[model samples]
Target: MSGNRSQVIIQSKRPPLSSAAPVKVTTPSSVNYHFTRQCNYKCGFCFHTAITSFVLPIEEAKRGLRLLKEAGMKKINFSGGEPFLQQKGAFLGELVQYCKQELQLPSVSIVSNGSMIKEAWFQKYGEFVDILAISCDSFDEQTNQTIGRAQRGKSHVENLYKIQSWCKKYRVAFKINSVINTFNVHEDMTENITGLNPVRWKVFQCLLIEGENTGENSLREAEKFVITDQEFQDFLDRHQSIKCLVPESNQKMRFLDCRAGRKDPSKSILDVGVQEAIKFSGFDEKMFFKRGGKYVWSKADMKLSW
Candidate 1:
């Protein structure tokens, strides 16, 4: 989509696609464990099939926390249909607070659809999160409504600007996340978002996951927004500070990986770590570090990092 005459997107040349194929190897992931499903937005990008609504039981999460620490994972992120939906929105604030104060995890992040966000939630628990990735596909209200974010007030641009104000006030990491497809491909991306927030924008290539209510159809509409792998690398280079990582799989896609080298044949670094943390909520933070193993990013292409 060409932007209004002389827009940066129109003037900017897109990069080419890379030859890298999705490889299959299991290595310890540096950004380790994620919380169970629990989100509010019926996001087109979620693999949960528009269903993020549940925190892992306390017993389960405690063990999961321990395993994550042992693996030497640098960051722990919380994502769900809407992670804030734990205990029906009321507990959202408490969940985040506990994650930071009690778990004491070094780095924690949350990806929200932002349709159900409340002002008070941010003012109170803003510090609990290290990064807040908000899903904002376009500036057009009609376009956003088509993609299932009807709850947002007025227009996408308005809500985004207001949300940015909150982020700035809290001094929290505020990233603008989007899965570009046809509907939003034409909007003024670099202009609309970059004008206000610099180096915090993230553009994601839409994944073709089946089963989700608005996945394939949305992707089809946003097809023009589809940039090949090389184009993505170029986009990141052009917008150097945005901190983008385009997985070959695109989203939390499931693929066959048998080389994780778990000590127990059935155990995976992700599985063992999350499971161990959930085992003992009573365990001390120090003990979790000792028992939870290092998270190994065992990729089909690269050897173990830790």
Candidate 2:
């Protein structure tokens, strides 16, 4: 599935931005929040499990929304195991509408795989949303089949094209994101994607996190999908016309740069187990630990007190 499918929210309420905000989002900045761990595609470069698990209960989400509204947060980004897959998306859509009409919070956005975003999903929330990020790694049919999204019948390339076309018909702006691994690291791939249309292209560098980043893991049947540096560089050179939207606040949106996970066990959030690690975002990032193979937030990882 798509990695970093986490939705980030604006910390304050303001007029909707017709264009992106000043690129440089700095520390103490709250940009994205992971909504659910459930996803359809298992991409090479992913970090969903490291951030969240299960869906945020509807009641809990309501409370979260109340908090956001009180805090004056206007814009909220929706993401998921295909955000449209949520059991009762209308509630989420309603939340967006509340922000748009009642609170007049600028705009809401959703990032999805676009497998089958039925008319109901968009009709109910499209007006409230600013954009829909459709994941399109490559325009190659073989590549889509190899990437494990083949069972969906239609080629990933065809689905992506349809999404772009529909967005145009609906008068919505869309962006395209791709994660790079050692497998598809060859040139001419991204170039092919850019050659078609002037879409926003996002390239993610593969990270060595959880399970296996290098060696081999039985879980990852598509290990050959890793993209190489030279291939990536050549494609970037060829597609100079494409817009690269690397967020200033997050270079690695889905994958955290945990280089320490390589040499030391304590450096990685996943390595320390969900139970014993520190928890961030209202909880201590280090307080997460594993119990019965489940990662749960146990205690707060409090820093030294003055």
Candidate 3:
């Protein structure tokens, strides 16, 4: 639900940052592995099929995770309907612990809808995680309800702040992922997102999948949410003052292989090896790395003293 909420242009008297020491680029970048499809919210524009099912067993899931590391993926982001929705993140924590402690992946992260996350869970496993990305589409409650992201009687914005504080306390880099669609494309989130100051604000255009979110047999209630590329850009233009803005139009989003069933079909790491699966899926390797898909922005790696 997070859009590139804001952008800040810092005008300084000092020299430009390009004069600083060169950054070491991590090779064999990252991949988004949709470990589960069980999510709480039923957003109309969502392209991922919402399922009340769990596929891989714990041990088998871990084996697949290790295979992904062996395939040269430095960062493995666990995504789903919501990664934190399972048993108060018990099963999710085990996977996170395994990736960081056993497989030793450089970056381990998750994309979640912040409602089910607890402070206790963060205290136990937060150190092992690199980033916690919350999907927050709108700051307005009515808009959220219209978009199907309401947290029952609770407020999503409130949960976001609480989660942000928890992330700060546990030293996990916080990120925001927003999908811009018709409902929220015109909303200005500068004041709210600027206050949060997340490390990254990933904004994506709303997309329609052939059989998943659209078409005759699909859950296509999201046609009302689709926005044109120009309209999406207009929204970004309105929030140019917010920092850490990374905008992805539908064209760019299509090239990201991790987005299940986008341009190429999704393949499970358990079914085929990571390399073979990515190869078969036609993931844009060079583009993926170039888009800052993998960076040394992990709070554990940076040790920011906030």
Candidate 4:
């Protein structure tokens, strides 16, 4: 493989797809692809923990994305361990360009810890990415450290501001995702969040996922981060004045329902195609729409002045 653009491809062995037709076909209007399960941050309450370091070959990944686009996928959110960590953001930049320029998808976005993103990455891939959702659990520096969101020699808050500025400079819609836990549930982030002025501020309640954050197979012990539903609601009530605030708790927001306490591994879309693989995704289509999953996702139609 080429050195300049190729990522470390650790392919997972999979069984062959069945020839039988699927009973139902789920139109994947929006999908999240956790391309790599490796991250630099040690966030205690992360549901999608670093269980494996495997990332499919760049060509195969692009092929899978093409399949999704052909299968009615409108929006594709590239998430990680950290999407930028692979090949120092080159891997992600290529995928973003493919989804927007080649596939002509309406929306291509990424969810990342702001630390790894640099101004140069934005310069190259900013136009392709509709939204950049940075994970910021707390405004307080000390609180962030307690939540394992702090990097050793860097200030998470400062990096957040720098990224916010870059987003504005590049005309990318900036967004924030905060997981309200015991560390930040009582803290009022009204002033800081409002000052940043994100197009959307997604406030999520700390959730537990078996084999990821909870149970025996988990990498992180997130029980300490858990809070009651009432606490989450109180936090929302406090931030009610923030017009862009979008609150999502365990009950209301989930692309896939793993309430059964164990998530069964499903075949890769590359192996079974998007139609068969999506059936086992446990995606809740109704709840996805109810929680305002769909909106003006395309940056082209957003009509924002750069």
Q: Whole-model lDDT for model 4 versus the true structure?
A: 0.81
What are the lDDT scores of the predictions, listed in order? 0.47, 0.48, 0.73, 0.81
Better of 2 and 4 by TM-score: 4
In order of appearance, the predictions have TM-scores of 0.60, 0.64, 0.85, 0.91
Give the Å error, residue 234, model 3.
Answer: 1.0
lDDT of 2 by residue, 142-176 (tens): 77666554445677776777777666555455567
Q: Which candidate number would show the highest TM-score if scored against the true structure?
A: 4
lDDT of 1 by residue, 1-306 (tens): 001110000001112335673532221233323344444455444444323223455555545445544444345555555655565445546555665687665555667766666778777888776667777877777887777655756565676777777766775666677766556544555566655562245566565433332334332223333556565455445545433322232422222111221110223324434333223222123322332222221121222121
TM-score for model 4? 0.91
Candidate 1 Cα errors over 4 Å, as ranges:
1-29, 32-40, 50-54, 88-92, 152-154, 210-306
Worst 10 residues of 3 by lDDT: 1-10
* lDDT (Cα, tens digit) per residue for candidate 3, span 249-293: 777765543345533353554565554444445455455545555
Clashing pairs in 4: none
lDDT, residue 197, model 3: 90
Kindly list the per-residue Cα lDDT of model 4 for residues 64-181, writing each as its tens digit: 8888788788888888788889999999999999999999999988999988899999999998999999999988899999999989878999999999999999989999999999
Task: Give me the runs in candidate 4 sitting further than 4 Å from their true place.
Answer: 1-24
Candidate 2 TM-score, true structure as reference: 0.64
State candidate 1's TM-score: 0.60
Best model per lDDT: 4
RMSD (Cα, Å) for all candidates, in order, is 14.0, 12.7, 8.6, 5.9
